[model samples]
Target: MEISQYSAEQIATLQAKLEKKLGPEYISTRPGPGGGPKLTYAEGWKIINLANEVFGFNGWSSSITNLTIDFIDVHGENPPRYNVGVHCITRITLRDGAYHEDIGYGTAENVKQKAAAIDKCKKEAVTDALKRTLRSFGNLLGNCLYDKTYTEQVKNIKLPPVRSSTLLLDVL
Candidate 1:
């Protein structure tokens, strides 16, 4: 969430890298308003959704119904950086073709403690959601950057352009 720690270009590059590594079958980016780039959560979900998409083993639709991430607050006095973070509920719903029949919800706050100290309720919400989704749905996360499968998958992918920054490496 610390914008000062990373340039917008760095963020874009990291996102592009993730997309390339993860494959686009179950992931895609939503363009931002100013044409600057895609939103961060939109970028992050390329892997997150892919992981959940494998849940069809039990007759449940395994695709994310929705996902949202946003900068909740900025902390630190001298740095004036983004510290506190929140993740809006990233939802995965079971569907029957066009009509969704069953609903299950997970939030980062549901697993991790809400960032009461930094006011990062949303960030907590996402972590919690991911944890709960994995627990409830069984670990179905497919080839993701962190997944062992991704290292091999990357070789098959053509890397995309990106800016460099350690902040972007935090998720790794």
Candidate 2:
């Protein structure tokens, strides 16, 4: 959506705040499949907290517009094992009417229960899509992790935590 609806000064100030480097405290690394390189990211809750920090708790919202099973494979008959994959698209809308959307995928492998696998994959997919869509906002939302150089420079720089009570007061 067009940010033109917002005043230039308002947009610039918001953009600058969002563009600031995300402190390393919000970042985490997890082991990747096949013992490959570790995956670095901010947890889903961190993204939600960052949104509240930058946009105000009531300033933005996200919705899952689409969700579907990308693939399902069931095999091994004894207890029945299955693999599932899910895809979802999420939209993030600012109170001002500007918006962004992105798709995310999740997979559950070798699970013994189909229903549980689907549930797990769906939640994972939606969370991934929410984070991906929100990342469009700016670096604090995760856009910087995509930039290896910038990430390398600030990867270890941690900032003090943003207390939710302080944020709530700001909303008042």
C-alpha lDDT score of every prediction, in listed order: 0.40, 0.89
Candidate 2 deviates by what RMSD? Answer: 4.3
Q: In terms of TM-score, which candidate is strongest?
A: 2
TM-score of each: 0.26, 0.85
Span of ten consecutive residues with least summed lDDT in model 2: 163-172
On a 0 to 1 TM-score scale, where does candidate 2 land against the true structure?
0.85
lDDT of 1 by residue, 97-165 (tens): 221222223222222223442344444555555434433332223224234454345445654555576
Provide the global lDDT of candidate 1 against the true structure.
0.40
Candidate 2 structure quality by residue, lDDT tens digits, 11-80 = 8889999988677887887888899987778899999999998888998999989999999999899999
- For model 2, the stretches where C-alpha displacement exceeds 4 angstroms are 1-5, 156-172
